[model samples]
Target: MQMGIVRRSVGALLAVIVLLGAVPVGAAEKSAPRHSAQAIGKAERAMQEITAQAARETATAEMQDTRISSVMLHWTPYPAAVRYAVRVLRGSVGAPMKTIATMEYVYTTGLHLPLMAYGAVDDLYWTVQPLGYDGTPLAAASEPCPVREAEADPAAPALTTEYAAMPYAPLYPVYSWVPLAGQKEHEVEVYRREVGHDRYVHTLRGGEYDVYDDTPFTVPGTYVYRVRGVTAAGMPISNWSAYGSFTVAERTPIAALGDSITHGGGAITVPPSYQLYDWESYCTVPVKNLGRSGDTTEAMLERFERDVLPFAPRVLIIMGGVNDYRVGIYGAETVRNLAALREKCRAHGITPIFLTATPIRPALMTARMTINTPPSDWWAHRDYVNNWVMQQEHSIDVATVLSDADGELEEGYTTDGLHPDLTGKKYIGQTVDSYLRTHFAYASAEAERRVRMLKNMEKTS
Candidate 1:
């Protein structure tokens, strides 16, 4: 019945909007092979963009009594849209990003996705894309919007921090704590260890604050941290919590930024790629996993700054294109995306480590008739992408490493036809870990990290 409601609403909306033209762009803008535009005045294209800009999309979470039950996204009615497709993306907007829900447009209102879809996640991010009849995308997607809980958490609040550079606060490493419930003040413990090999040991007592802006870190090495609630009497109120690792003097770390394969997609165990504990979890070197499932090269590039570059790692591990191949992206175009990524990494002095796309079973590709690359031509396309990957000095030959006799995914390495199983992830992790040890030396500096990142900004007036 609910599904039928969506269909009826979409059908009614489409009937009315059959004549409207020009919609905003989304991820499709970066890599859509060709766009079929209705003949609208040049002003219409520009007007649509301005209207979308003038109309800010809003997000609010639903409260089931005291608990959050869902997140609702609201946008101004686009008279031209026959229907809208809402995409609920996860923490980051890169490869392996999942599409949690797809909803039809209701013009003047908001739509929601169940809170459970987020799976213990808070503050989910998303964007809305306009669609025509037959599910053809009508316009570019809107800018991403984040949904945060307006209600309070009754439980002892969980905490996480993000590292940001402050020109004003030069002496201290800035750890901006995420807002928490039931506490105005918080305590933090900061510690340093070997880059990747050792465990994070609590080494220092720090102040309770909305941010960790005081206390000089003084040391020049990789560091990990934990935070907890503090009582008014200057006592501990909660257990120290763990988030992903942070850096102090990150020894020229390398980050793997790709889709599901790099993200440890399918079933994950022992450790996830997110905690920087997946296959890349060895040798005392940190490999930040910036992977999001279902990300194309173009989408990964769009999120380069927010997800990949902020850590200022000296190297980047890149593996993408399978998602693009599904959309029938041409080999030359896909290579173009990788080449652009390489150039960006170079400008930032971050060496690019290219990885070949893992091969998938022909049967799987065939069964998914919707995919642009069919079984007959998929192998050839993979070879083409792999050939390009091999041209790079730091390339890891994963396609060969994970290919079976029939040239699909290797028998024991995958959870399914396309994604890697635990064994397969280990194999990739081993290859990446070994390569990093042999290639890059133990050397990094603040200047080295900043030099390339600064050049990324275009000189705008």
Candidate 2:
């Protein structure tokens, strides 16, 4: 029985060997494929190459996204351009480009856009077409401007305030600067020019890019100012900017006091630093801009003692109430504020000239400023305030030219629908200019009479 079992095991082993092509274990190991050291190294290097290429591609994509987000297109303000048409094109230079994004109504010379808004494109360019009030092309489309990558870090803040010598210097000067990115606040230092040196008078800190110095410049003297950016931790983030100098004197001829409209700057992204956006820029007369960016009628009235008192302007053009009305403040409240402002002007011997508030288009306002939600009764409030203004002895109905048939701000005259752009501002400024020119001799005579009265009183004393 044992012999028979042994024969069966041997037969089974022979059958397995036959199934394995009858190869021996040692022979099978030798016949198997073997890789050379050189070959193995080459395979590993290829994998490293593939990984590096992937990392480079990811870095390029991230850089492109950063560039797209920071894209801001700026152009020279075209003459007679009520508005501009901006088109973003995608293609290589000298290649047939396709317009990917077109903004039909850009009110200012600058336009900020997220290039990613139109999807991924290897090459992008922009062009501007100046448009007339009637939507006619005022000039041919500008040559395509390449969308270059923006700088990683913008330069330090630079002062933008206009300086003048004593006797012509503004008493209530608006201190303004080009704000730095990531700035938590701005530090403004005022120094009075004293005995062959500048004496540090005061230092003020605020979050706003522009400051209406409420501290009255009562003394007529030379003053120097500088600004720097600060971090939230109270640490200085930038070096002191180049000094700005102005001389302070008494009695400004004419000044404008209002909200952002009179403060200058329109078109959502542009700041008041750009002169073209300022209505005062279009005026023939040199009107000092006392208009703060976000002042309501109440705020304007409150600041009168501090801001308007120092200037002692011969004529103060008052345009406000839109900030109050948009937020649903009662028209009566705004009117009361305006009345208070008028009374204060009279008390200080300053002539107060009212400007009818411009109408607003809620749809456009929402599109431009999502945070803004003008009340449903906003127009009613505006009408109430404007009606009161019309009854004032010294008033100009600027709203008449800015409002459409439906009483909304005319699209051609505005970019944000709330603040009037270049065209509307031009109309407002020119109207005021014409009015002032017409009554120039009368105003001059009144000013002279006041001067004579003051001199006589001084002589008697």
lDDT tens digits, residue span 396-421, model 1: 88778678777778755542356665
Top candidate, metric lDDT: 2
The local distance difference test score of each candidate is: 0.55, 0.72
- Residue 377 CA displacement from its true place in model 2, Å: 1.4
TM-scores for every candidate against the unseen true structure = 0.42, 0.59
Model 1 residue 43 lDDT score: 42
